[model samples]
Target: MSTTADRTPTRHTAGVFDIRTIIGTLLGIYGIILTAMGLLGDPAYDRTGGVNANLIAGIALLVAGLVFLAWAKARPVVVDERELARGDDGNAVHEAR
Candidate 1:
């Protein structure tokens, strides 16, 4: 006996990992670091010698990451029935009625 899956069609989809995704990931990481600095200790500035660049940078990264994440989530992912049934060689045949 054979599975109907063998008769079904298969489809392959390429992964999506573009510059935006990379940038978003990097920014998110930076945001975490900045947030940590903001919590741990004070930041240093060139003029005032007490600037919280870390906090600012962290916020920026967090925001950027969020935006990219949103975009990524918005993308749709689809799988055809044929693909799912490709390997199922079960009783799929119908008698002439």
Candidate 2:
């Protein structure tokens, strides 16, 4: 006799393993580093026509990273334990033959 809880699907979020999360984290880290360099380090205006490339790029990366993180937070990937357990076996083709 299965209870209501037992019949319900066991689901969980992809968490840190999600691609968006990984990308967001990496971008955010790099953004911070670049932004710091642009602010404190020497900004050679000669190479980029007086434009602070590091600062501009860092800000852009930060914004993109935030967007990705927000997207992942808003719509997380859910995984069902039942589905994972029911994954196809390698012998399926052999059996069908």
Candidate 3:
């Protein structure tokens, strides 16, 4: 006799270890640093043809990071305990050849 609890499946999500999360975090950090430098440091107009390279790059990185983070949040990876427990034969117990 199986109870409701026994029938229920166990699941978990990939949180910090998710690739998107890692990428997003890295991009965000770089963005903040670059953005700061762009604002505080010299623009070096001669190098980039008068364009604020650091500022532009920093903003781009920030936007990309946000997008990655949002994507990760919207679609989280789910891991099912039961699926992991299954053997090649699709059963909990492995069959001997």
Q: Estimate each model's TM-score.
A: 0.52, 0.88, 0.85
Off by over 4 Å in 1: 1-18, 45-51, 76-97
- Assess candidate 2 and give its lDDT: 0.83
Between prediction 2 and prediction 3, which has the larger TM-score?
2
Local accuracy of candidate 1 as per-residue lDDT tens digits, 4-87: 887654533212544456767888988998899877866666644676777877888899897986665555233444645654
| Candidate 2 structure quality by residue, lDDT tens digits, 11-47 | 7888898898999999999999989989998898999
CA lDDT scores, all candidates in order: 0.64, 0.83, 0.84
Sort the predicted structures by TM-score, highest score first: 2, 3, 1
Q: Worst ten-residue run, lDDT, model 3? A: 88-97
The true-versus-predicted C-alpha distance at residue 87 of model 1, in Å, is 26
Which residue pairs of candidate 3 clash?
none
- Clash pairs, model 2 backbone: none
lDDT of 3 by residue, 1-97 (tens): 9999888877777778789899999999999999998999999999999999999999999999999999888888776667667744444322112
Give me the displacement of residue 88 in model 1, in angstroms.
31
RMSD of each: 10.8, 7.1, 6.9
Q: For residue 76, what is the lDDT in candidate 1? A: 25
Clashes of each: 10, 0, 0
Pick by TM-score: which candidate is best? Answer: 2
